[model samples]
Target chain A: MSEFDLIGRYFAALGPERSDVVLGVGDDCALLEIPAGQTLAVSIDTLASGVHFFADCDPEHIGHKSLAVGLSDLAAMGAEPAWATLALTLPESDENWIRAFATGFGRLASAHGMRLVGGDTTRGPLSVAVQVHGLVPTGAAIRRSGARPGEAIFVSGTLGDAGLALRRKLAGEPVAPELWHRLECPEPRVALGRHLRGIASAMIDLSDGLAGDLGHILAASAVGAELELERLPLTSWVAEVVAATDDWSLPLASGDDYELCFCVPPAHIPVVERLSETLGLTLTQVGWIRSDAGLDVRRPDGGQLRMPARGYDHFPAANDGAD
Target chain B: MSEFDLIGRYFAALGPERSDVVLGVGDDCALLEIPAGQTLAVSIDTLASGVHFFADCDPEHIGHKSLAVGLSDLAAMGAEPAWATLALTLPESDENWIRAFATGFGRLASAHGMRLVGGDTTRGPLSVAVQVHGLVPTGAAIRRSGARPGEAIFVSGTLGDAGLALRRKLAGEPVAPELWHRLECPEPRVALGRHLRGIASAMIDLSDGLAGDLGHILAASAVGAELELERLPLTSWVAEVVAATDDWSLPLASGDDYELCFCVPPAHIPVVERLSETLGLTLTQVGWIRSDAGLDVRRPDGGQLRMPARGYDHFPAANDGAD
Candidate 1:
């Protein structure tokens, strides 16, 4: 099909004007009118083949994962998902691949109430870059600089599953289907982030490993952190599976978790509990914001735990890196 | 250097914040608040190496050209450029390339008063996609559907020079350095677009060749066109060059001419002339919108001009059923 016809058939399916979107997916440009008394939060993320994902991963999962990575940023700021634009580079224009990608991307977009407003498709090696925009009430966004010295550190959902699942996939192990699913599709904790907006002092999504990502919050706020290794919130199934293996480091330094981590004041403990129960989500208090400038881990026996502190660095792997 | 360190040193330099920019680059997300009574006009364009430019093109020009492409979209909507976000895909982390790119990008951005807001950098084959946001007063945007029959079709600047320059560069012709510069740095007419906000009925940027792009305005407005080929505004040098060439097809149908083509009512001709002189830009009447649905080009001898229609199509060349 011609490029225009292809776009009209496949891409036009991604958007149609909704009440909030003044214009969607057509013409020379897209028009949007932000609602009064609100701030627009914008973030962009790019995922490359063999860099952000495995070389043989499913195309549908890649589509879902690309949008999810950008959504995670919005979740971190407690913003309501609004609109998105995509830039897809492909080696060839495959009709089947385009249809499947649009379907997967459309599903996530509909779920999050995000309008796929515009994008560009071109011939190149496979990669997907998405820019997402969200809305938050005036001055109400939960920034990383808002954390205080005595605030309680919390994380949603289990950690290291995504990283561990990736390892299993790479090793070609006979793992359960759930492992593949976890490695393929990650759910960004958007509802939990919104619930924590008014209560949490600081927030961020765990794209890099939790140990590394938490450091971002600390550095941004110019504060420090104390993490309890025993309280790291590993799932029972994960614990059992790792007990049979010698290496458990993946769980601690695995990236692509898409989980929310935030700092909340001591006084809001009861309110946070209520929110967790209401959202039907697990919220584990794993650490505390420190007055000092370095991160330290405490063990179950109250001994200091030394961690090499490495995660997914965008550059080549080096031994001396911290997080 | 690691992606984190590279971002800290170079990517962060693109953003240090400025007036009219509520938030600049950095943080988990960038925040921007559109002015009250203004509508945000956004456009996205992706440029892939070997597709948009030659493999040996300078990194600095590539960065500048990428932004220019998106900015032209804003000019079509008669919107004032405000901010932009970039998504860069590279084959490897090259520090020198990144520095040169930032330098070129920063020069244009500073000159246009556009702030770099948010972006993503990833490892992949070379590609640069930018999304630009412009502010236009509500109800004042010049859309593609507003042209009425009998409106004068006008274009700013000479056509086909960029495409011709590219041919010259590809053939290693070293006539003048300015010709090569024009091929690499075709500036978007931002001031002209903003000034024409109340004057033009329908407007569009000519990136996809005059015939193909002007057809868009025709199709969207549900109208037709009659072009006077003799009236096409070409530089004296370009006219002489095309007259001697065996085929003037590339000059007519080749893409990458980032000039503004617009439709204005006959009553506004005096104002257009005044504005053209004031801005020191030559605005020439090229054609007229009609009630019929087919394009007709009138030659200088009052005969029909049958020109081959060619422009950049994303699908493989064979898909044109040269398949």
Candidate 2:
């Protein structure tokens, strides 16, 4: 089929029809309206097959994860997801694969009321690049550099269940469907992020694990952090995986959880409590920011827990990345 | 080097710094302020090595052309280029290669006062995805469906030089430096497109060759076109290639010419002429829109010139994408 035909069949109408999109798919460019007094939060991410995902994995999960990761970035900035443009590189024209991918993508995008405004489909080794645009009130974006020394560090949802799933699968062991689902379909904390716009002083998405990703917040804010290791949020599946693999690094330094890690000053903790109750999400306060300048992970008994040797780097890495 | 270090070394400061960017590369999402009374125009395109260009070719050109193509789409909408996000996937961390690539990308972006607000760099087979955001006055952006039956069709710049260069390279023949340069670095018609905002009824960027790309305009506007084949603007090199290769398809059906194809009402011709002179660029009138609903290419003797059998398709096609 022609490139245009493939685009029409799978991607012409994948998400909600937002009124903000003036000229959508099948245009030289998509024209959109950003309301006055709002800032545009834009993020671009690429998921390369074999590097980011296995080729044999379900295409639906690939589609879901691709948009999820970019939305996660927007969520980090307390932006409401608006529009996305996809540049999909395929090895060949496989209608079934494309359809499944679109289904997965459409479901999440529609749920967020985000629209697919533009796309380019081409032949190559499979890679998907998603650029998501979101909106936040002018000057109200939560940046990583805003955390203060006395702020309480909080992370939404369980840590590293996605990485734990991959580890179990790679070890040739039986994996729970729940664990695999977490690996495949991460929920971007869009609503909670927007609600925390004024309450959270700093925010980041947990893509590169809590220990490393939170370090970004510390480095940018020029503050230190002390994490209570026992308070690290976990699912039963993650606990089982950690006990079996005997590796704390999956929860500490591996990647792809897609959860929001943020800091709330002492006075805002009450507001966070009200938000957690309203949103019905597990908002765990695992640590606090300090005046000193380094990350310290503590044991329940108060000695420091040794951190991983390296963070998950996509290139030249000690981590296998399911290698 | 670590992923963070790689980003800082190569991409952190690769484009012009603009005041509109509230937060740039290091943030989870780039925060940009789009002015009130304006609309956002967005476009995304990907170029994969060995699919779009030779993998062994200069990375600098890859960087330049990647941004050029997306900018061409924005230009088609008569939008002012503002920001670009690069999602670069490389096979390895070759610092010199990345530095050269950044230099090429930086040059074009700075020339237009555009900034690199965000990026994702990861290990994979070489592919570059560029998403560009530009601005146009509310309801003033050009669309492909705006042409009327009596409008004159115009195209900017000489056509087919890029395709001819690729054809010669693939045919194992010596290619001119000028022609090869066209293949590597085609200029985007940003200024002319912005100038034509109120004047041009319809517009498209010629990424695919004249005959095929022009067909998109005809199809969208639901009108016919009659082209005076002799009036097609061409460099002497293109005429030489046509004579030597005896392949009209290079000029008519291949891809990668970044020229703007547009329609102007007869009354606006004087304005176009004035702008052309003021800008010191070639703007050729090649055809006129008709009430009928198909395209006709008339030879100098008033006979029809039989068009090529196929237009370029990125997948399942007769044309080698220089394949």
Candidate 3:
């Protein structure tokens, strides 16, 4: 079968049932009927080999991670995903690789109720881009600039697992199978985002490490913060993984953790805990939004914590002195 | 400067008014507020070096053509383009190349009232993918499956100019500058599409040649058609250019013509003419939908105009055994 035919079979299965999706994947252009009271949320992300992912990574993991990254955007906005479009470029047409990648992508998409509406598949070096669309009620969506000086910063789930997993993979260590899965398929906090929609003031997904991603909220809102290093909700597994390594800094600064880091007024922390219980999601308070213009760090001994400040920069480290 | 910084300087200038774009290019996700009574029409296209374009073509042309191809999709759906997301892959960052490309792309996008809402730029072999979204009234979309057997087939503007331009460029022929511009910067029929919203029964953009693109409408509607050679509206320039060639076959079979090809019921002919007058877009009657299972072409002498039945196929072309 031709590439179009192959996509027709598998790609159309990614859309979730929505009133606006009048026509789904089988056309020249996808037709959508935006309902009366909703705004569309759109995000596009592309992962390229040697920059975003390893050249020799499994194709299935690559497919899964691409979808997760796009979904992470919807999570940031507290929007319910409606549809997704995929553009896949491959070095060459290999039937086995395409099949595995499609299957992996389909599994994750189905799990999240995302429909594949339309896309283009072409010949090129391996890269995948997913453009995701979601619907949020008008005037109700969270944004990065909504945080206030008195707000408390919170993050869903633990960080550093993905970063540590990448470290293990890069070092050719005999990492646990779970570590590989965490590195390959980090979950975007979709359900948590939906549940926290009305409560969170500012929200963003942690793709560029906690420090950098949090910095976005600060920069956008014109505020800064102080985070207690001991209060960071690192999983025991992450602690163990880092304890085995001489340098665990990358786990704190490297990226690919598809978790939600958000802020809420201190008065809403009770409501946040209540929503977390209702959704069965963990909400950890890590820092406080401050009126100051720079980031500060605190340690468990009540002393100031000093560490190198660095995160994922799109350019090489020489330009920013990141390494 | 890195790719992101480059986007910040040049490409970001095409953004819409802040009020119009609820969320703009710098966010993790961009949000668009669809007015109370609008539907979204979306299409995606990928252009890869040595596949969709020549390896040494001007980067400016490539960028312009990429946006034009996606805009053509909106034309097919009879929707007003409002936003576009660009995904660009580069082997290395070239400041001059990106600046020239952005200049061409931004000019075209602004002309069509499309905002560069968001996109991703990455390091890889050169590739460009664009996803465009347009708005239409509720329940007023023109789709490829809506044509009936007796509908009239029409094409906007001329066909095969881009293909001929490519041929001339390949042969290093000195063609008129206008023809080269047509090849590089073909316009998408946005206003014509909006005028045709309720009149066109089935529609598709002519990117994959007339025969192949018409095949999409036929396959979707479960009908077929015949074309009258004498009625084909080949431009005078194309006729002059191809007069010495073996045939004017590429005019009907070669791809990359961004004009809109659509079907309308015979009764809507007056409406189409009025639309053409109002929008200043040509509406030429090229053929008619048929009940037959396959396509047929009639010659001027009432003989068979036996053109080769082919379109842009990705796989290697097997010898047809005609010899």
lDDT of 3 by residue, A23-101 (tens): 8776767888666677788988889888788888888888888888998899899888888889888776677787778
Candidate 3 has a DockQ of 0.57
TM-score of chain A of each: 0.94, 0.95, 0.92
Candidate 3 residue B180 C-alpha distance from true site, Å = 2.3
Q: Using TM-score as the measure, which candidate wins?
A: 2
**What's the candidate order when arranged by decreasing DockQ?**
2, 1, 3
**lDDT by candidate, in order shown:** 0.80, 0.87, 0.79
Q: Residue B97 of model 3: what lDDT?
A: 87
Q: Per-candidate interface C-alpha RMSD?
A: 1.8, 2.0, 2.3
DockQ of each: 0.67, 0.71, 0.57
Instruction: Please give me the DockQ of candidate 2 compared with the native complex.
Output: 0.71
Clash pairs for candidate 3: A14-A114, A14-A115, A14-A116, A15-A115, A15-A116
Reference contacts preserved by each model: 0.73, 0.85, 0.59
Scored by lDDT, the top model is: 2
Q: Which tens-of-lDDT digit does each residue in A113-185 have in candidate 1?
A: 8888888888887888898988888788888888899899999988888777777767877657776676678
Tens digits of per-residue lDDT for model 2 on A60-138?
9999999999999999999999999999999888889999999999999998999999998878999999999999999
Error of 2 at A255 (Å): 1.1
Instruction: Compose the digit string of candidate 1's lDDT tens values, residues B1-323.
Output: 77776776877756335665555665678888887999888888889898898778888998789888888899899888888898888777889999988887877777777888888887778888898988889989888999999999999988878777877777888646666676788888888999998899999898877877887888889998898878888876568776786344444566788889999999998899999999999999999999987678787778886433334677755444211
* Lowest lDDT block of 10, candidate 2 chain A: A314-323
